[model samples]
Target: MRSPTLARRERHDLCDLALVLGEDAPTLCGEWTAKELVAHLLVREHSPLGALGIAVETFARLTDRAMARLGRRDFAVLVEQLREPGLTPYALWPVEVLGNTLEYLVHHEDLRRAQTDWQPRENTPADDDAIWTAIRIGGRALVRPAGVPVRIRRADTGKEVTLRGGAEPVTIIGSPTEVTLFLFGRRQLHDVTFEGPTEKVAALRRAALGF
Candidate 1:
């Protein structure tokens, strides 16, 4: 819920942390190195431009070409280029601004999940509200519940948002960053704490699977 400027600063904080964490850390996403996650972010940052259809087509073609040519040794250089100033314009509309931010914020949380040494600036109530709404929008592409309600509560502030009216509610309680990582599918359910019906929660978890 930080200001756009503050949010960008937060992103930089994570960038520095990733550099320190090294590419070989055990990330929540399979065995991906922190560097690889940043590479994926770079790809997403440059892929969105013009209309959704055009943007998608262009991104696919560009990514294929880039992946073929860039290779692992050159990935960091490419990522540095894409993360340069004013690169946000290349992202698709809506996604360019909001989705990109959401993407980074969630992954940054994922990269920092287990470490107690790092702490993201706490999100204010207003910031939390904005992120809550933004995630609900982006999460649609990610989560499709089969009529099961899921409620998320933030640790920084005692704020709760509920997606209801399905089978039963599967509530997850944790810090906002942890919740974000879980919802983004970077972290496993084993890393999360859940309450309510186990079967229903499992079904909802299956529906909420992340990439």
Candidate 2:
């Protein structure tokens, strides 16, 4: 779950992402402008709490509009809108708070990858729990085919988890942020140190997304 403080911090981090995108700058998500990112977030903030399909449709409409008229100045306004209390639930996830945390941290990294000084500082324990849950939910299996085993360790908490079976054992060690990105198809394996058999990692990389 997200603490109130962490939720607020993530909101701010997302707002900063929009602010830095400049008036017409494009984002890493397709051709979405930073303003479009803000618009999408705002729409998500206001989306229905029930019915996932309904939420998806609503988000698509909002994204379409945002893409047509996104601008830096508009993004600035959206940032201010986010600063207000109770703008929406502000809870990052619908199923589990940990899921939300993982989403925020990973997306924050996505935005930061494009900026020189956009790093968002995360509270260690929350991020740790989020990463652990993300892996257990079968996120690690996303890179490879079924039946690949993966051993992951959280550097901050020194907690080690192993997802085993189906081919070979693949080992990965690093911060939660690093592991999350790797599972989500963002960061490269080179940024992460891999041990165990090469075939294991290769097979794991070819597996489908578990969760």
Candidate 3:
């Protein structure tokens, strides 16, 4: 039977890459090094206290403390911890697929794209389809905060999402991965084309596009 664990596989590969890149390598996640990024992943998955900090402003300090503490641990050990199965609430099947597929994929690219010699990975069609599904399910919220009429189109498959409640929407066209990155507020780094009214497109480009 075919496996239903593609996201888990991606997470494993990301963890392995983190271990290889060492602790001080730059990542697309602001000033976070690979170590910080790995710490974030560990806290995100393993600690409810840390995870709460992600959504609750009041918990921000606790989250930072948790990450800092975790970041001090040996790097390879942390990566191994990330590879451990069923260690967090997010480890369940549908949740793993829904929550982590895009999370890990985006963060994986965050590491790669931050490198000067980076190139986009050749994702399988299955991977694209999975990301597209994520965009269709959760992308609207990411775009809605920008308060603009925006449409996202996948160049490879012609799939599109219209995220506006008004006319004269801005349409962004790219591969599924690129569109996902754009929606996630990585617009400056994503390779995409915008087609719409010049003013609207320009505004959309300048507007903060993600959650």
Residue 186 in model 2: shift from native, Å?
0.7
Give, for candidate 2, the lowest lDDT window spanning 10 residues: 46-55
When 2 and 3 are scored with TM-score, the better candidate is 3
Clashing pairs in 2: 143-205, 144-204, 144-205, 144-206, 144-207, 145-206, 145-207, 147-166
Using alpha carbons, what is the TM-score of model 1? Answer: 0.67
What lDDT, from 0 to 1, does candidate 1 have? Answer: 0.58
Task: Write model 3 residue lDDT over 92-205, tens digit each, in one string.
Answer: 888888888888888888888887888777788988888888887878888766667888899987878887757888898999889889888784354689888899877776
Q: What is the TM-score of each candidate against the true structure?
A: 0.67, 0.67, 0.93
Question: Per-model C-alpha lDDT, please?
Answer: 0.58, 0.57, 0.82
Off by over 4 Å in 3: 1-4, 188-190
Q: Total clashes, candidate 2?
A: 8
